[model samples]
Target: MLETRIKTRSDLKGLLMDAQDLFRDATTATGSKADELRNRGLNLLDAAIEKAQDAQSAAVSTSKEFAQSAGEYVRENPWKAVAIVTSAALLASLLARRRD
Candidate 1:
């Protein structure tokens, strides 16, 4: 099986769902083959969970860095940031109105 990069929330949800389904089947299985399959599933689920935790930690760190950098930039250029935000909000509102 190919490992996928869980970069988005949707990807994480999908991985969790897959792991859950496998676990559900594993619990109901019997005999040596079933035991083998269950062990494989457990290993896969464990790896996926570890990877998810690592990704979450990395994401949190990256987001904090980005926010700190953005805060510094905005503090140095307050007016520019305000103007940009105002323009973006205005454009979003206009787009919403057009959709309505």
Candidate 2:
């Protein structure tokens, strides 16, 4: 689902870029054709903004769910959580020392 959202956002971004280019090109035209291109560009821009907002909402929801699940796990296994953190810290310190 996340991958799909990412792809969708990428597609929308590409489309938005295309729309902007079209709009810029429209500036070189005269009268009705220019108006049409500008209108089309605005429509595409609006759609891209809407989809971007939707992706952001989904990401926030997914993060909240993961955070909630992690909280539950830590509550259920406090000692194990502490052990994991300690081990991770030790590993990080060792890796950092190696870089020096």
Candidate 3:
């Protein structure tokens, strides 16, 4: 899943770079060539936006699943969850203080 997200981000980055190049080309182009370059750039940007939306949707779904599982665990073992959270909070605060 992480690898997929990373790859998606990488792909999006490349698409954005290509779109930028197209737009730059359009700026220096004339007549039909300029219009074609602009259109291609717009299409690339649209594709990148769609891919980003898909990745975001997947991340939100995964986060909701994790939250649901965590909630179930906490309900099943209330005291254990409290202890774990307390320990984590204490450790985080201690580490933060040390950093300060």
Candidate 4:
């Protein structure tokens, strides 16, 4: 039932927010519980943020690698790449004319 109350990400976020507020204002028994929950939630949030940054970094690195490789390929076969693109554009234009 308690876990069901936090069935979604938004619900968990609300819980974390409440815990933070309690920890901020607590001076009673609730303070200890609030502190524990707040710390755990903060840890989870920090770990998630770290993993996301790592994934983003990896994606950017991969994209740069792909772009560099593609550039090298184009440089190594400039005329062939140009002819292929030109042929595709010509075919597209011809098809569009027929459609009109």
Candidate 5:
């Protein structure tokens, strides 16, 4: 009877060791998956930042071209440009006052 009890206890210890090893393997797998997800998120954010920078550069270039064209037009037609600008300013002030 004593021998049988000792065998049973040893079996239980072996089973416990197997369960611990399985748990450790699962934990390692989960940690690796989490790290992969974190890296993917960072990559997506970097791509978005690069896209935004490109868009900002394009907008600045377009604005500069528009300013140059408007300046040339005003130089060519000074009176007409002055009248258009005054009317626009008056309309804008009226709209601002109404909003306030």
Candidate 6:
């Protein structure tokens, strides 16, 4: 019976060591996976920022061209442009008053 008890204790110690090793391996694996995910997230964010910058630059260029064309059109039709502006102003004022 004493020999059996000693053997059982030895077996328990070995199992404990194995459990500890498994826990350590799991922790290391989780940390490595987290680092990989973090790197991927940062890369995606950088790509999104670059795409946004490109889109903003395109929008600015388009706005400039549109403004230039509109200016020429307004100069060619001064009375019509004035009438459109007045109508827009009136509409804006009416909308503002309604909001209030």
- Best-fitting candidate, measured by TM-score? 3
- Model 1 gets an lDDT of 0.77
- Clashing residue pairs for model 2: none
lDDT of 6 by residue, 3-94 (tens): 64465456555545555555555556667775665555555455545655655676678789999999998999999999999999999999
What are the per-residue Cα lDDT tens digits for candidate 5 across 1-100? 4564465456555545555555555556667775665555555455545655655676678789999999999999999999999999999999999998
Give per-residue CA lDDT, model 3, range 1-100, as digits (tens).
9899999999999999999999999999999999999999999999999999999999999999999999999999999999999999999999999998
Q: What is residue 39's positional error in candidate 3, in angstroms?
A: 1.0
Rank order (by TM-score, best first) = 3, 2, 1, 5, 4, 6
**lDDT by candidate, in order shown:** 0.77, 0.90, 0.99, 0.68, 0.68, 0.68
- Give all TM-scores, in the order shown: 0.66, 0.91, 0.92, 0.58, 0.59, 0.56
Candidate 4 to native Cα RMSD, angstroms: 9.3
Off by over 4 Å in 5: 1-29, 93-100
Q: Write the per-residue lDDT of candidate 4 for residues 28-77, one digit (tens) a residue.
A: 43756867756775776665566556556766787899999989989999
Q: What are the clashing pairs of model 1?
A: none
Every model's Cα RMSD, please?
4.9, 1.3, 1.2, 9.3, 25.0, 24.1
Cα lDDT tens digits, model 2, 33-55, are 99989988988888888888888
For residue 77, model 4's alpha carbon misses the true position, in angstroms, by 0.6
